[model samples]
Target: MSRDTIRADLCIIGAGAAGLVTSAGAAMLNRKVVLFEAREMGGDCLNFGCVPSKAILSAAHAAHTVRAAAKLGVNAGEPKIDFAAVMDHVRKAIADIEPNDSQDRFEGLGVRVIREWAHFTAPDTVESDSVTVKAKRFVIASGTRARIPSIPGLDTLPYLTNETIWQLDALPRHLFILGAGPIGCELGQAFARLGSDVTLVEAGTALGAFEPDHVAVLREALAADGVRLIEGTGVERFSGEAGAITAHLAGGETINASHVLVAAGREPVTDTLGLEAAGIEADARGIVCDDRLRTANRRVYAAGDIAGKGALTHLAGWHGSVILRNLYFGVPTRQSSNPIPACVYTSPGLAQIGLTEAKAREQYGGKVSVTSWPFHDNDRAIAEGDTAGGVKLVLGKGGKLLGVHVAGARSDDIAALAAITMAKGGTVRDLTGPVLAYPTRGEAIKRAAGKHFEPVVFGPFAKAWAGLLSALH
Candidate 1:
């Protein structure tokens, strides 16, 4: 058998959002671009992570709304859930978006798309099952996958990860989750709402990296939604028998579950790609990239979840664009650590952008101002009967908005707006002067901004305001 050889200006591995975007941009520049993918083109986000999860969450939300119809003076019974149909809806959502990332679409854009597992044969060359590709510059956007832990008897038990959890034909009678990160919390709540007994066990605290206050709010909501949240606990091991998996905790507690999900963390897909051939550096954390998303090897670059920074799809898109700018134009675009928003898609989705109160105080020596407003006080929230969440704004000494975190309805969309303001170095005054639409959740932003009014109004203008008011009277 003869090995095939192909050459291109740029070779990109992994046809997820990052690889696809990079391929499209390079092809537009008339650069000979070749992209490789081992499996699906859209990667985990479209196939397993964001798209499918959101679709499932939406169905769960509708079911929840139907159950709550009694409060609105409408007689509605409990939602009848057909698990297979729900899974179909999730698959349909992915299929609907698949064509945009199909191989034909990239081919139309002048990109050579190859479906194969590519490993580096040299710094400039990669060999797959069928062909060998060589290029001047290479991008590894292989993305990350669920970090499967080494638990005794785990291999014998059937388990779920974000990747295969969506393919479930029927909802498990009891689901035991082993992480309290964004994915665990979101999926746990959705399953609980859909009538599954969900137990979310966190090794540390729930939403461990978030501000303590935000965690408190989210924890309360999850508890109210009938999720058995176990924080600051560790899973000692797992035992599988009689078609069920039993998770033994460190404290001698055991949770017998029909299914076990390992949402602990994610490991970057850099290990199998043979980075040494390119002299690139990576570890369990991820590929070590500089500010420009360039690896130790100057000719190579990395982005998206593989970069191991912000793992959101939006950030992946942003990083992809930056990689192209740095690669093509020689314009060094640095990835910003600030103003990245992360959203948890639960009943009341938690959207967090910028810095948390703890982080801001740590960085600024306590010269930070924090203010918030609950959705219960907002008109839209009251009408919608989802007044369980709120928004928090963090600011530094110079009135620089450090972060805007929201946990409520449509928070993902709202957080994008907050990201824009924080990215531009916006301040409370910027939020104050704006007349937000009436009867909307966004009004909470303005309401939170109003907290700054008391100090300003009472400090220097207190006597002037009293005199003016007395004269008018």
Candidate 2:
């Protein structure tokens, strides 16, 4: 038997956001491009992760708002949730976004789309069932999947992961989650609001590596949503018979749920691809790429979750653009870990950019100052009845805006401003001097910065300093 060969200027593996965007850009530059994928075109984020989850979160938020009407002086009855309808909404969201990332769209971009798994057959060649792709440069945008832990008997239990959770037909009467990270917290709250009894268990304290204040806010919000959170505890054992799952805890307790959701974490999906043939180094985490998003083998590059540089879809897209610039235009661009923003899609979403307070204090020493202002005090928050959270700004020794953490309505939107400021190395004065609109959550940004003016406003030397300046004039 003889093998067939196809040649392209660039060969991209995985048709997710990173791979597809890179292909589109590269092809537009008149570089011959070939793309391979073993799964759906839009990858995990479009098909399983962000889109479906956010759709569910939106529906859950609406339901929660209706239930809270009594407290807002409007007494509405209990919401009758149709789980099927919720799933329908999720599917519709996927459908609406699918066309943008469909195979037809990529083909329209003058890139060859191959719906097959690719394996490296040589240092400069990859082989799939139908074609042998030869290219000067390659990109590994292969994404990640839910990482199910090795809890005893967990495999035997009827469980769900982000990949399959959206496919569920009926809502679980009770949902037991095994982690307290972003995914666990977001899904736990959403389902609980939809009338499911949700129990979330975390081995460490709340949302382990996050800031203490953030942990407190999330804990309080989850508690308010009628979700039972078991922190500082873990599952000792798990067993399943028929459809029910019983998880025995290390603390001599047990939790029974109609379904178990293992949102523990995610691991990169890079094993099946023949990386060793290309001499590329990777681990359980992800492909080890250099500052320029280049693999150890210079001919290959990586982007997105697979690169392990940043797990965000936006970051991945940015990395893809950087790779294109370096490979095509001969421009050198590197990845930066600073000023990246992430959000948890809860009610009054939690959005964080740059360093946390503890991190700032440790890295920059005692010269850092922290200031916070509550959303409850903001006119917009008060008017909207969502005065549950606030914003905090961390500044360096000389008023450099080190970070901004917001946990209130429109925090997600506010994060863009924070990212741009931090990336541009702006100071507190810049944010404070801007005249933000009245009755807006974004005013919290300016207000938090204004707190730095407190000493100038009422310091012990205020009168003396004013008199001295007046005399000098």
Best lDDT goes to which candidate? 2
Q: Residue 50 lDDT in model 1?
A: 92
Provide the lowest-lDDT 10-residue window in model 1.
451-460
Candidate 1 off by > 4 Å: 462-473
Model 2: CA > 4 A from native: 457-473
lDDT of each: 0.86, 0.87
Model 2 RMSD in angstroms: 1.8
1-473 per-residue lDDT for model 2 (tens digits): 46679988999999888998899999999999999987899998899888998999999999998988998899888989999999999999999999999999989989999999998978899998889999999999998988988899998876889888887888888999999888898899999999899999988875665557766777788899999999889899998763578999997898888899999888998888899999999987799988888999888998889998767877878888888888888988787744678788887578888788989999999889999888878999898887878888888978987778888777889767777777778888888776777868888888888887888876879978888999999
Superposition error at 218 for model 1 (Å): 2.4
